[model samples]
Target: MVNLKLKLSEKANYLAFLIVFVSLGLASQSILAEEVHEPAEQIAPHQEQFEAGKFVIEHVSDAFEWHILTYKQHHISIPLPIILYSNNSGLNIFWSSKFEHGHASYHNFRIEEEGEHAGKIVELNEAGAVVGLPIDLSITKTVAGIFISVFILIFIFLKVAKSATSSTGRAPTGIQNLLEPIILFIRDEVALPTLGKDKSERFLPYLLTLFFFILIENLVGLIPIFPFGANVTGNIGVTMVLALFTFVITTFSGNKHYWKEIYNPDVPWWLKYPLPLMPIVELTGVFTKPFVLMVRLFANMMAGHMIVTVFVSLIFIFGQIGGPALGGAVSPVSIAFSVFILLLDVLVSFIQAYVFTLLSALYFGMATSDHH
Candidate 1:
């Protein structure tokens, strides 16, 4: 019965993962096929527009401010610190609001409204044409989100640790109780199985950290308000860094046998001779493994966020085109779909964290495995 229960649990997890992936990917088709309508030749200077594509993209993209809501053309957002350095401006430190929600320029540096540099800080020449770029070390929305998520992870784990240490023999309680199963799951099911008992303990700490960090960030991004919804895990840059860490650890952990398998495996001489085809393929696999890790997490998390935003945007799009009545009619349906996706995203958050950690553990095991 215990074994049967475990099998069922594993099957359920996979089923949920497939559901989230397929549903989110299919729902995002509308967003991928969205048409960007160009502006008229002569348009009003202060004209308002509701571009669904921009709406969805802006929500997923990083920003200098934490936008709460926009009411009556008054943007309500928490401005993050803007730390910039440039040849012309030297070092300018100020609030992102000094740019006034990208409406004004500060110190001749402004967030580009359009063109190739859209959504980026650019330095302007005397003629107002873009001339240079600044080294931006600002605490943007995504950066802030990362900081928040890291803080939450540290706080929760520290408390859990303290609780476990204080009562050595007693049953786990509170946060420790909540998280103990997950920790054990990583150990018994993921690490121990893939990496074996010898090295699993050695790498368990990193695997736990990786799993929780990605999991927390993924869940936090689903929160649609204040300090939480920065889309940190959805960002390709963040995923790339996470994947690079796994790659670095795997490469350094590789023993002589691992490299030997890559360079000159126990295969046909023809495969490794002349053009060194097998070696080339094996070398390519080294790079592609991490690349796949990066793209998979980024694409999956990004699709979830984008699909939810697209559903919510539908209400506004209908409202604009057919006024309040049409929008009011669509609001319930749109929100229902958004809520459904948000729930799926929660499941995906766990699945992605598990998948990344599992793959990483497998790589580490292969790298450190002894030639028996």
Candidate 2:
């Protein structure tokens, strides 16, 4: 009995040891993953102070720096850095000695040597040149992403449309086969449900375009590579443009009933007689609706990315404080949460795209509806 008890005790100790060993192994991997992808800004303060195991979250969150030119005009420039692993340093435009990893610089432009450096911009001899002037004209990561997304969507849609026309009204094939169902879902589940059939078709093209554009941009932002990771939809400028397009369409298509509800609402006799400033309030709401759409999408997407970055940064911050063990222990939880957020982001990308499309369609329906 004593010998049997001894053997069981030994087995329990071995099992405990095995569990500890496995847990440590997983924790080590989690730490490695966290360090390998550290943001550029988090790794180094000025691209000159990078460190190992701190590659992913080193770059500036927004990267916007204003430069005041000799001409006294304010210009804005933002750098989009390329992410690379230590082994892939060769791909970087410039290697960081501190980081031991290479990084490719984005928004590379020369400031005229003559200008005062107001932050990031330098004044040019001719006109104050923002280091990166005419943003839309440049070959930025966002621009590249936009072009790629546009091309893919256009190509796929055109092919599908052609196939539908050519095949005696049969269903599409290949890429079209993949896209047709999504299109139908948008039309049936999203468009018709919100805008009704007759009104929905008119706005279908724009809604479809917006949906794919936002979806592709959101996905591309996650890649963390050159000519990628531009947070296109998170940029307020991009969101504003999209919202403006929807607003214009909605306003232009508004029927008499829609305008009547806004300009001359059927309120109580006293409310209408006193000329209660209802018209002004209603008029303002027309613009506010699109503005809300822009802010909501931009804020939500950007916030998620920022939160992931902050959590990842904690590992490095803790490591520097002689708490490597604690940092190591915390790493698994942090990485798991980051991965969870990333997965959530994927769902959000699709949901935002759908929501934007559905709301736009609803507005169109309201605009074109026969009754108020």
Candidate 3:
């Protein structure tokens, strides 16, 4: 009996130690998982919405259709989707097509065919044209906003410019008072420094217009709602068109001196002649310069937006399965980084606009300069 009692006591002690070891293992695992899982989950929300927004921008047609059949069906249409989040409901998805004006029950439609949902595979009629066009009233809203913004800026500036020339040498009043300093700065600092007093005045109108237009558009894109978030400057086509205008203006404004410099550059004899290849290479540089301008602005703007979106997405992906503890751990980090990027984006907005305008003015100055 004594031996049996001793054996039982030993067994109980062993079991207690085993429980402690198992509990320690699980506790460590939970800690590690929380650390690893938090950031990914925190970023998920930003990622999901950003990708969804980018997809919509890439696929959604801006072309307006007057009638249902007259709809220009270049690509398949998915019902207009929106991402909604609030403290009360968490996250919700809504389709604009599902809701009717003043009606309560939402009628949502899903894509029956693969192309329709994914925005691929256009259907063409016998005349080899698109069968139907997606109704794009959204674009009109965007256009209206752009027009209003442009009109306001232009009207205000034109008034300011006119005031600067008016009877009294004293500064203008009202909106003119607000904008006078910026205009003078552009003229004195940007233009005079780079293009000189004589040539700078000639290009001032275009430089100011470009700068203000881009600045407003970049700010508007940050709104992240309907009639906004159109990625105006980030759109390659828009940048290309703007670049083309600059190219045309520069080309037409080019004096005999500009052409002489390109065709007969003042270089070392070896480089100027270069057997036969130097002329060809030198000529190519002229075209390549404006092309670089188009690509640089578009790429920088698009890339910054994409990176911010990716970081924000980590929250959504990890949070879905992580529950509270893991999600909470990651949210702060993701939000912090997103805020950092947002601040950087603000600087980038101005920098990019300034660079584009500055380079354009530089080109114009060179084009119109008198021969040495």
Candidate 4:
């Protein structure tokens, strides 16, 4: 009986680990959030309705102003700097607050509410038509998040490095102690096997940096607060840049053997000569490899955030349609599922980091392989 009970307990613990994760927003998003609202009376009837989709999109998307929270139907946000340059305006430097939550214009500039340039700062003519766009080099919310994460990464490793060097023979302690195994895991299980001793030693630094950078960004994005959550990995631009780095590294690392495989791969003569299909496929793969890395990370992180927001939106959906009593009744169930997803997402964050690093190492291995 005791053995059976322990088995059941083990299963329960495993099941518990499978619980929730919210995509981009997680718990930080409010279903009924008053998102930079203009006055209700002036708004259109359809516009007054609750839009979970809009909220989710806004939650995951970058913004000129960092929205902290909403209270008493007021949006509390920190407006960022707006650096705009146009041939006409010369250089218009101002704060995002001047736009007044997309309600007003400042100087000769306005935040377009609809059409092509919606949510963008467009330069207006004297007669109030949008004539052109300024070169906006503002430090957006995502940019700020990247800066913060970079700072944290630097701070963490510097301390870990100090602790490691100072305690040479002694056992690791504190943060160094905690991260040692993880560091070794990447070096041993990931880099060493794929790249071998000589190459692994040389490339381990890049691999380690890649692993921790993605892992930290993924985890921090789930926090849902300032300097914590910026949806860094979910942003395609960020992922694309990261993938490009891997591509550039692999390209440069390629040996004579690697290039030979691409242009003059060993295959049946008919297959190569008929239409050059084999060579085309081989070359295409070189570009596709990094594309896969970029899309996979971006899609996984982006989907997770959006799905959770959808799950949480259920509560407000029911509340709006059936009144508060019914909404209250449904809250627990919706929240339970959201929590379940959020928990599962935590596991995914680590897996994605490991996978990205592992694949990168594998690519590096293939690029510099000594094999025929």
Candidate 5:
């Protein structure tokens, strides 16, 4: 009996040791896996300087150079032209690479990293007060994006025109085939219905340009790739310019009736006699119409870009905290959401273009209406 008891005790001791050994082995394996997968160099800096909001805002905002991606300690970027016109320097033109990614200054000019003039070119005096402000006509990332979109537009339209002339009534082919229906859709569904056949004919060119320009910019901004991804339409300046064009066209197209409608609105006699309330309200609307256009486009496009960028940033944030395994686990969820937003943004791009065009056409129609 004593021998049997000793044998059983020996077996139990061996079993306990085996279990401890297996647990230790599994734990070591996990640690090794994490060490192997964690990208220490890439994530460490980001973790040190990680301000989630700042990271997100920077990605959405315009930059002097086009930042493509980063690997290790290297940043792959394309430096754009930094064209500046200053009182002292006249025309100072150079590639943005001279700034060494905003580290070094050149020719008494530097890219402002903070304050109201952040991301702008400002010339400082010896005491550091801004003395000479340069007119920055630089081909910034946004400008480069605009140039790319314009080139695409010119290329596509030229091809479409050539096809229209050369095909000689044959069915449209290639890009022409795809875009013809869209163009026709714009004319038939949007232009004719809003501006009437005659007015639509008069304003079709402008409306078409407006529609396609916004559509193309929105699509390009969504790409997040080189020479294409820029928040041009999302920029308030760009949207304001577009709105200004609509405002100017509407103002020019306004006939006597359109003016009379605002200045001497057909309202209750009391409303006009005492206060000109109707006219005042109508006048406010004239300006407000364009303001709404500018805000709507800028806000919508910017929001979409921000959301996608934020989701992408999450992967890095997780990696910084729990190493690559946690980051890898979160990536699938993050990417799925981003892809869904991107698809939604695609539809929004078209809708926004259509809405802007439709409203512009409607405004034109109202201005040109003879019945009023």
Candidate 6:
């Protein structure tokens, strides 16, 4: 009797399972039918919506305005000045808002939305062809960052200088108290070791300025806020300018021994006279040094910003593919890694700045080194 009852219960459970299985199959079939009936245009819109890489590129690249954040369908951004000059246009000055965030053209000029010129201001003809290159000396996001950094540096140093003068023989106080140790460290620890005590004094001001500028720019980049965090150090143009300064200083300051080592390196006589291999190699090293400096700082800073952005993007990527539950599950892991990298990036910021300044000083030492 117990076996008979168990058999009956198993039959009932099987029947209930079949009903659910059939229901799901029918529901899926209906969904498929509806999708087939829908027009291609309807599906095309969905395909355009999930673009992760685009988001990454847009965030890192320089823009005319500063995009703060997006809420729902509205984008909040600070408009910057758009200064353009062309043979035809003469000088067209306007706010970036005139372009409506790249949605419309203004005065026969539009920010290129696609292609190689994307994100750049170009003059357009009646036929919509790019007619001329506009000199875009406008104050862009990166430029704004530079201005802010310069202002801050000037303000801080000026305040400290005033305090030192006013205090006279008394102990240092306020901003002077804070900056004194750092300035001393760069002088005694960095410059003295690399350029020696006597020579370091002459270049101490420039070295100090270089170190502080890089350090401040790096710190500001990690903020991820408005009116700041413009990736100034990451921009190749800015890095190139910094490297050029080092190169110029090293070239002008090079002594007899320095040029002698390059043009007449202590190598096999055959290498110098016949092939001029040693001299050629040494001469090549001169340009390569600054090239390395430019590439190193630019690559490191840009890479850090890209990595942090990619990690944060993972959450949205998961949500798009696997629904909200999967996104929620991935959030903790993504945020954890991002935070860890951010902390490491802070350390990198100091290290990069020190490395740059230290290298510059070393080059200076080598350039001015006295040889018997």
RMSD to true structure for each model, in Å:
9.6, 19.2, 25.9, 10.1, 22.9, 22.9
**Residue lDDT tens for model 5, 1-372:** 223222322332333233323322211110000001223433455526457898888888888887777555466677777778888779887778777777667888888888887878889766666775697777666666766776677666666666666775477688767876777788789988988877776777777777887898999999877667899888887788778878999999999999999999888899998788999999999999999999999999999999998898899899889999999999999999999999999999999999999999888888888852
Q: Write the per-residue lDDT of candidate 1 for residues 267-358, one digit (tens) a residue.
A: 89988878799999999999999999999999999999999999999998999899999999999999999999999999999999999999
lDDT tens digits, residue span 4-101, model 6? 22232233233323322332221111000000122233334333455778888878878887777755445677777777888886988777777777
Q: How well is each residue in 114-195 modelled by candidate 3, as lDDT tens digits?
A: 3443432222344544444333223222243344445445555445545545625564577657655655566677878878
Lowest lDDT block of 10, candidate 4: 19-28
Error of 2 at 333 (Å): 2.8
CA lDDT, every model vs. true structure: 0.79, 0.57, 0.55, 0.76, 0.76, 0.76
Tens-digit lDDT track for model 2 on 1-372?
A: 222222322332333333323322211110001112334454544424325333333231323211111121211222322222222122222112222222222323232323353212221223433433221222233443454555555555555555655664454567657765676677678877778766665666666666766777777776555445666777776788778878998998898999998889887667656675787788898998899889988888887777677668777667666567977987888899888888898999888888887888877887787872
TM-scores for every predicted model: 0.86, 0.65, 0.62, 0.85, 0.85, 0.85
Candidate 2 lands at a TM-score of: 0.65
- Compared with the true structure, the alpha-carbon lDDT of candidate 2 equals 0.57
**Backbone clashes in model 1, listed as residue pairs:** none
Measured with C-alpha atoms, the lDDT of residue 88 in candidate 6 is 88
Error of 1 at 319 (Å): 2.1
Best of the candidates, lDDT: 1
Give residue 250's lDDT in candidate 4 (0 to 100): 99
What global local distance difference test value does model 6 have?
0.76
Better of 1 and 4 by lDDT: 1
Across 150-221, the per-residue lDDT of candidate 4 in tens digits comes to 667767766676666677777779987777778778878998899998898677767777787788788898
**What are the runs in model 2 whose C-alpha is more than 4 Å off?**
1-122, 125-137, 158-174, 323-327
